[model samples]
Target chain A: MANEVESTPNSYPMNGGIGCHSYVKNSHIQRALLHAAKDVITEAIVEKVDITNPWFNSSRTLRVADFGCSVGPNTFVVVQNIIEALELLYRSKRHNPEIPEFHVFFNDHVHNDFNTLFRSLPFSHRYFAAGVPGSFHDRLFPKSTLHIIHSSYALHWLSQVPTQLADRNSPAWNKGRIHGLGASSKEVREAFSAQFSKDLQAFLNARALELVGGGLMLLLVSGLPNEFHSSQTNSAIVLDLLGSCLIDMAKMGIISEDNVDSFNLSIYRTCPGELEAFIEKNGHFKIEKMEELINPVRWDPPDFQMLASHLRATFEGALEEHFGNEIMDELFERFTNKIGENSHIIYDQQYIKETEIFVSLKHRVTDYEV
Target chain B: MANEVESTPNSYPMNGGIGCHSYVKNSHIQRALLHAAKDVITEAIVEKVDITNPWFNSSRTLRVADFGCSVGPNTFVVVQNIIEALELLYRSKRHNPEIPEFHVFFNDHVHNDFNTLFRSLPFSHRYFAAGVPGSFHDRLFPKSTLHIIHSSYALHWLSQVPTQLADRNSPAWNKGRIHGLGASSKEVREAFSAQFSKDLQAFLNARALELVGGGLMLLLVSGLPNEFHSSQTNSAIVLDLLGSCLIDMAKMGIISEDNVDSFNLSIYRTCPGELEAFIEKNGHFKIEKMEELINPVRWDPPDFQMLASHLRATFEGALEEHFGNEIMDELFERFTNKIGENSHIIYDQQYIKETEIFVSLKHRVTDYEV
Candidate 1:
């Protein structure tokens, strides 16, 4: 993939299904993220929703989608939490009327292992579940039909690695890097920023077509914390280590150096300003709240093994695709040893492990007309 | 020159949306019918259903249908009751830890007022709803897919009125009379009976292909009492009064006398023996319980004006089609006056009111192997 960046799956899903090391394992992180958006989510269910609104209430069915619902035990867990939260809000109403019935759609890329997602579903008489495999960047449902949409830890992923990054003549070309990281060229940063802006606009445009008036959308995505810029957080360190490992491998002649030079991770670290600017430009939704959530660190960092395994689950597929599958075990082993030897790493800085940007947008009434 | 037969609503729906005299207003009759089948439906819930079976239980989504869901306030009511009953069964056992999510399909003819159904739907956070409009006599759903099916006051309707009733050469041709009634020719009776048998078989066969093993079906239909055959019940009085009204009009040169000869209601009254023989012949479901419900007389019949209005609302379309719309008011006025003049008619013989056949069937296990 030195030039052609069309190959996707290697960089597609974080992991498959509900496994010990799969996406479910990191649910505590998502649960915390959901908790951060509880106020807005509750507000969306109670204050923002009109109980007697004919478009949604008259149908007696509530349609919801978790747009980037990767295979999960977490998917079910997060939705369950949301339902409970919404139920609590409904119970507190003065009139205390009947609640709308729920139809939940769990959506991800077409290649996402939906069978595993279905197999692990928790039984309930409260709501119905279906797996809708599609990209959130495109329209995946009937127009003006959804009442609520939830997406957590997903939007930061761009549609693909920026092709502009590979153009030698382009000012935004990214060279000698796998992602926009420490001391990355302005060109690298611009390429990633441009891709994110385009993708976010497309996402907003599609969702605008799908949500009913007074509908709400809650999103939890990775972002730069306050006072941070490109490559400043601990997330950047992971990229630093990843790129270093590949470079180290290239020097050893185990893989071609040109492959490492042309590859760039298709992801972006969004700040509040960037999020606001994108929302303003799209104009489909009215932003209710957009804030950063950087938790107070409580526990000590996990050992090298735990850290290594987490990264492995996420980046192993991408690495194996670019390099041969045989280099995976050895590559991670080197990564682990390198992290273990860096004594200054743990004490010098906060890695920004849990900083996620949370945004809640109410579907604008004018857009609902369509 | 023929026996009396009252007209069917100009053809019948009580009212479009859920309202007084709507399907919901007839709740008392349905309630009694549901209670009669409670034992078998319970047996279906506990013994017949395999809880841990993956085909249904493992996926965590349960699919159900109400085959002739005309329109709602009652559609929601019945499905709600079923969910409640199913939940009650789930709560009775220590191992009843899991209850699958429910996806309910509301089905009817393509011409059914689904818009009104959706508009009047009640709110609930319980289960999801979707409208599937199609004839139940055909395959309305995917084969071996549904778990439980409920149809009330629908199957007694033949696919269409027996063609033989209009075929002049057929022995069963119902000329000069609209339906099988006392003193009606044996040919008319046989024709209607054969049509009913054929339609019910088609209905059962379609359901057999859709239900999972151990799935249950509950049906409530208008039928004759133990002492009554086709023409002996009070239901015949409706046809009798209708035919009389039509013939009277023809004598007056109000409606073309020949028009009445070609019109027949596409409904049949099913007795226990008939329903039983059909199930036996179809050989897909086991008759867990089949009973005749005969209530003690309690209330006086409605006045002719009220009766005429109710009939008008239901059969007005069919009536308007066969007879000119201009004659509707005059027709019902004549009908009301005729009943007023027949004060001694009630004492002539007992009319079959408040008698319906209730049957519950369990899908046989061998057929579940699809």
Candidate 2:
């Protein structure tokens, strides 16, 4: 698998679908909210999901999956939270022990290691459990089987970057590529919007087919509203800082300008109201409850040491692939020095919140005919 | 003159001190702080004072004063915030030029209003200025010659109500004082702390003789340091809402307990750190800068409207008092029914920052040589 993945010299195309740790790192906030969500879901959807009468053969068996299960503290938190809620739900049904039990599944991409997920699981899973691997975009689960689906900090990536993005001759696609710049130029803004809408619908379509009747789907994703505009000065500051670092690396002949130009990373953003409406439009599911968390999505303060370490990590992954490890220390020190002077607030203003977290629940009102 | 002043009927004392409307009613936050102090002094001070300042060398010129000046706002804000360093102090000096010109005395009572003071006046006075009003226990200036020594929100009938407070051992003093409960009782907490010190220093001795330096002591006054000791549960809240109306006539037997106590008034609280320290040390000064103003100090969501209104004029003076009257309806509704239920932040939690504005400069630095 490693050879196959590495054989593709310009594997950047396949990387479009490869979920980055940035998204995974973004899921940490969901952990803090899981406890509060227990009551909210109970009052809003749990009691409404009536599984009374065993003979009626309702969709009594629950399969809860954390779909883009990230590594580290967040994944553990979500898994534990789901189990806690399910246990409470089970205890509530003590009068009728005949109630069907819950089955848990944790799924992620092919690149995600199952060993880590396996080690993190609790020993006591009274209800059944499984670890599914493969992209949700592809066929990863059985048809119409999932009862409750939750994917926090995922689903923003397109199945693949539009081919026309690199094709300069195709005016429409080239325009779409340019529009993804810092959220200024309305045309570029609209370009990202159109692509996001198309990709989001595809995501919804895939989940719609997998969810059983009366299943709940909870999703948390990142986005910036159209109203948000990065001030020219702030953007300039970040660009200058990053530009200097890239220039120094270029002088060292580590990474070529051509590689930087050809690189196309997906930056996804969606409005809360628009996303909610998008889910509602998908006929297979009914919107049971939707709420936008007021706090920022990726807002967390990084300490000075963490800042230095983050620079080192970035270099290790992409930079070290091109440049030998010898220049690693110099490159990291230069980056940190620039950050310390120009972007001191990236560390000092760490306490200021700037991320948004949203939770949405979807229940299967109808089975997929196809 | 002293006996005549003492004999002048108690009509002024019970007449709510000053008319709610006569003072400037449209003051902004800065102005409201000074104005409210004017009222706090009128109602709380026991004697009529010459409110002016006397120059040290040329005894004819007026001396100005401010207690708890804490380096005057401008420079200190920079030291604390680091962002907009010295900008606050620079702006304050530019606006209130009077701070540096007169024989201006800066006082902090002990805990020091240094943040506000330092940020207010940065450089040395172009004309002449000094720091004098120390602790209200010892005299800061001489007798009967003050031209104008301004202290806003400084005097509030002492910390705990005077020691002789409930000693109705003399019926005249005890009458209807909280059902025989002395202000210094365990239930009242620091209520008598100020009065105990004041009586030992001969009841307002500090500022009594310091006026030999000035004439017009413009004072800003009001009940302040809204501390609560379980017994005073929601006293500020009750006064702001229900008590203002009923308590007025309740004392006259116009309303019964069923009608009066049933209504709760909202109370606003301030820290005792400023006034408590000043009273304990007993620094004396001429009462010059005296005027009541309201600067509504509150929290996010503005849970207490009535309290905000009552405190609004404390700093910004009559200007804000008028402004508050206009929005009284919506403000009261929001405070009573909507505050806790909906957390729509109406004001920053640090709203009404300078609760009561007191400005009194010292004519003498310490007790006279006699």
**Candidate 2 error regions (>4 Å):** A1-48, A53-60, A124-127, A168-181, A185-187, A230-244, A294-302, A307-335, A344-354, A364-370, B1-370
| Residue B271 in model 1: lDDT | 72
Per-prediction TM-score of chain B? 0.85, 0.37
Candidate 2 chain B: worst-modelled 10 consecutive residues by lDDT: B8-17
User: How good is the docking of model 1, by CAPRI class?
Assistant: incorrect
**Model 2 Cα lDDT, one tens digit per residue, B319-343:** 2232234444443344344433333
List model 1 lDDT by residue over B43-135, tens digit each.
556655555454555435567788777665556766776766666655665374676666677776544555456545563326555555446
Residue B195 CA displacement from its true place in model 2, Å? 88
Candidate number with greatest DockQ: 1
Clashes of each: 30, 156
